[model samples]
Target: MGTTLLGIDTKEHCFEAQFHPKRPLLACACITGEVELHHFDRENRTHELAQSITSHSKSCRAAKFLTDSILASTGADKFAALSDLETGKQVWRCKLKAAGYSLLALDTERFAIGDDDGGLRIFEGRAPKAAVSWSENTDFISDLAMGVDGTSLCAVSGDGTLAVYDVRKSGEKGLIAMSDFQDDELLSVAILRRGTKVICGTQTGVLPIFSWGDFGDQKDRINGHSMSVDAMVKLAEDSIITGSSDGKLRVVAVHSKSLHSQILGILGEMSAEYPIERLSLSPDASTLACSSHGRPSVQLWSTEAARRLMEGESWESIFEVPDEGAEGEGAKADPTAAESDDDSSEEEQPKKKRRKEKKKGKKNVPGSNAKQHQAAKFFAGL
Candidate 1:
């Protein structure tokens, strides 16, 4: 079956969309200061409106569902909100001195927020106390992602800095300061394979992967797309999926060095042509939720299709050009003459080819004259 837009809100301008960990529906929030919940059936690829919430005074940037039908959202108005999913009611909101950009639910009671003043704050569940707070940066944190077990946090700030913090430690565990590039902002981050490696997205279209717990080790940069990498999500233990401002979702196989990408655009532009803002994978590895800014679209992809693409045979033909089309194969493939040329070229070319190859090479060989003189002296001595 084909995919369908289950529902859309012209007023909300959805920026991020996330699914309930155990439920069949998804939730989203908008830059126009509203939140919405959507119910979907992937089997039929249909979406329906579940709820529309207007809780914040300013634009809401991030939202995620906690357990027990509870939701949490952050906005540009320096507030972190806790809501009831079924009732669409705000239970509590903790105010911060600076505007908050990202919300990560640690548990039903505790959550983490990255603020505009380059601060990382962890708030207690259902309480007013701060669990732990650190300001290791002087710039606003653009994106924050927690490890699978919630023991490690990866934060990328607006200053093009990426740092990982160990939450279990009483003091500091250390940090990996990533390389900065000109005219690029750190857009997003993700943890791979239970925090064994870290991936960071940048505005200049580079995805840098770092080994966990290895300070000062240079990261392996994966050059993927031509525009800003807005979101990255781990699909499996060995693979990742990225959504970009270029309106494409790319699955990168780290182990196999294979890539499967689809452009949802037309004429060398992102097809469906929306600016993809975020990506989130289901906990069971069955679905991918994509959120967009330009079209305010939330698209779900089949996890099985994603897995097949990741495990499929290599796609090396995308770079090659056939010498002849199938219609001209008979004229191009003189089987007997081609075999004879192969044998004759192999036998006749080696010695003659050596003289021609070394004509310009002998002068640049590192120690060729010294070795030759040494060999001559040894022969004379013998």
Candidate 2:
């Protein structure tokens, strides 16, 4: 099982949670229009509220770490603001034409926000106004991702399109390409496979893969989840951690050559009770922070633990189901047995209980030898 390092009860739903670029701090944008920073001590396995700032008049929809000392946030109040993390004060605030739904940090000196009216705006460091704003998407922009070079920006929208822009240019000249409308709304996006592929998470649980420059249509699709993939973060060039509407977080491996993908492992033994809303990986890539829709708490998990399981011999067992047939056979054998034997001594009864418990424990272990051997064969073929 993956280790849960900490859980913070915000008492209000957190729309997003982001980790500091250099410090062991987490920033959360909440439904109450508040932005909170929490300081965590990994050695002691504890966390405390460091600061809280009222950022918006309405729900803060997204937040991103612009630098080690600055956090950028946008909200339903139609405003975007930058706050100084050390002083816990607003650096500058700007009112947009519409409510901002997604935010992305291009670099320490520049950032971007996508608003509810399909507006995409880029703002230079501490600027009170957008350097440039445009409306290419016909619906709300659900997510935004920055390319590896920091010059290319991508946005996924509720209108079922993926739009790309060149941060170096402005207005229509910056519009690189806009994809054809897909069957489902795009919720999240990531640039993967060394910037050769753009992966867009859809409302229907499919990942539409677009070739870097070819946004006309999806080159491939990976139907990996049973519910909507609400959020995703690239862990490696070929792997990503996806949070789904089914409340499960899974590590998936993407094969560029074969245009195939598979679930490498799941983050936890059991799914959360609510849909996952956001996923943020720490700068060092050692920790992951997650928040769920309608949930009042944020969970921090050990990323190393997940990586260890993925690379371990029992990786395939992460999603294994219990052997119901074996369990049923055991149940049948005990159906007519008495709860306690009247003729037996108390000492004998205790010993019998111990043996039964040991036997039950042995039966619950995942992946038998045969199953493991088969898994090896299956992966070899891949």
RMSD of each: 18.4, 16.7
Q: In terms of lDDT, which candidate is strongest?
A: 2
| lDDT by residue for model 2 (191-242), tens | 8888877898877778888877666668888765766788898887777788
Candidate 2 Cα errors over 4 Å, as ranges: 256-260, 269-272, 294-296, 309-312, 316-382
Backbone clashes for every candidate come to: 6, 0
Name the candidate that leads on TM-score.
Answer: 2
| 1-382: candidate 1 lDDT, tens digit per residue | 1232233443545668888888777778776667877777877767778787876777677887777688888777778888887787888887876767777777776777887766777777766645777675445676787766566667776555565666654223323232222234567777775566677777777777666654222357676366667777777766777776656666665534444223111111123345466777767877777776444457776555446556562222321325454111111221111101112222211121112211222312223334322322221221
Q: Would you list the clashing residue pairs of candidate 1? A: 6-47, 109-125, 264-271, 264-272, 265-270, 265-271
Q: Report every candidate's CA lDDT.
A: 0.59, 0.71
Q: Find the 10 residues in a row with the least total lDDT in model 1.
A: 333-342
